[model samples]
Target: MAGVVTGDDVRITRKVQQLGSSTLAVTLPAEWAREHEVEKGDSVVVQRDESSGSLLVVPDRTLVEDAETTVDASGLDADALGRAVVAQYVLGRRLVHVVDDGPIAPAHRDAVLDAERGLMGVGIVEETTEAMTLRCSIAADDFELPTLLGRLDRTETTMRDDALAAFLDGDAERARAVEQRHAQVDKLFYLLLRVLFATYRNPDLNRAVGVDTGFPLIGYRSVAQDVVLMADAATDLAALTGEPIPATAREHLTGLEDAIDDAADAARNAVVDPSYADVTRAREALDRARNRTDAANESLERERPEPLLRLQRAVCALSGDTRHVRDTLDVATRLTFRDGSGATPE
Candidate 1:
């Protein structure tokens, strides 16, 4: 027999412990009793060990502590779709279910079936007159946070490039297309944020994914916000060029385009490289772009007296666009680097 004492107020007594044919058993630990709020009269749940013929009496609180969430993906089950959801949950999927009541789409149903037997299992748990429930088990190896982030970054880059190119080409139709792309960017950005929220909610999934997502997500968010601004600047530039500008104004616009190109190139490189030295160089180039815009604005003020007021206003608009371009580059550079002491997150 063994005995444990915690001062005079608490004392634990132990008896013989059984092993085999000549085995014996003892009472539960007193410390565990106090920790679990179990008293002499309090009830507990007894769970039998499958392999070891041992009974484990645990407090009810332990069972109720863990929460299981359900993700609804009814009638729209595909192999890829299931895999995607499983992957999402592994990064930390709560309770996910697929239900089909009325006429469900074939593709969706297929996706739901396809998701079965991977990390997530497809099982029919309940049925009703209206709908049937298919539940899936979420496992760890399902989500790759870095890969997802890369995909999102690529999508953002594509949209930004398309919008900037359309504005530079002076094609109103093409610039209009950028608006549609912006909607896509917005959707993607929202989806990524949801994934991040899941990461925070599910700790096991986060450990399994083994990614340092906090920083990258911040960077992507900041960059995405900047790109949205970039898209707006493109829209404004498109409006500025809708009418036939004067020959002098056109020349000035062309120079602004050249300045914008240089600044964009510098910013893109800085964003990709994300080094202090590279950002410093990009910042220098942007400063020069600002000087170019100022010079062009002053030239219009002096050389074109007849339309001086209108010319100045147009110059201001173009300069504002350039300023936005500069700011985007600055943000990209800040996000690229690790030790940005005073930089904003994302």
Candidate 2:
């Protein structure tokens, strides 16, 4: 039997008594057992916490259940109602009830619908004058973290490419499509956040998804956020310059674009296959990209069109985002290869 430590650090001492020739036993504290609603012959799970070297005695009756929360949205505006619903979803609530004692305002109902559209697996299953019910249809096992990350990466890459092409070709329709696709990126990101939060809270879920022991959850979350930010930067870039880019400015922008792409590739490699060498290469690439962006900005004439200025700023933002990604990979690499002295591997 394992020792139990209470929150007050009070250690419960028990003697190991021989029950028979082959059996030994330790009695549990009545108070503790009663608190957990343990009864005679009830099943319990005993597992060792590898990190803390503590034995955990968990009641097997603590079943994983779908959680529900009701938000009293009485008199709340549309934005507030939307934020409240999103908060519940992010908190891992499977079902959310947005209720008003009186008739639900049309604006408030629209807000709930908007929130559902923005999030993944969330939908309004039922709505009435007094209440609206939002359900998360996605199961924890529906998708794995690695697959989500891969999809996010691919989606963002496509968005970036399309945005660039739209800008260069002056395709207003394609630009609108790129903007619309950002919503898709947002969906994947929100879903990934939900999964990451769940895995962070439950070790079983973490292990089930095969998260690397050396890779911190926060690091993965940061990478996912960085990917989204890159997509946002692409969207911003695509929004500028509906007119065809001038040949002169386009040449400079293309160099900056290529540099950003190279830096992104290096950062992705460092994160997916972490090593000191990969991180170092990513850092170097980002540095070169930064210098190139500065040179490109200088090459643009001071009297250039407003759209070109916006494009220049967008390129700079993309460079900044790529640097952020490289920095995240740098931290991930250090965490994965820390020495006994806590120093990163050379």
lDDT digits (tens) for residues 44-115 of candidate 2: 766554345666565654334447889998868889999898878877789999999899988998998899
For candidate 1, what is the TM-score? Answer: 0.46
lDDT of 1 by residue, 141-244 (tens): 35454444445445544544454444445466765775555555544444444445444333334455543334443444455555556555545544443433
lDDT agreement with native, every candidate: 0.52, 0.73
The lDDT leader among the candidates is: 2
Query: Whole-model lDDT, candidate 2?
Result: 0.73
How much is the lDDT of residue 338 in candidate 2?
46
For all candidates, the clash counts are 22, 0
Tell me the spans in candidate 1 whose CA falls farther than 4 Å from its real position: 1-171, 199-211, 261-273, 305-318, 321-346
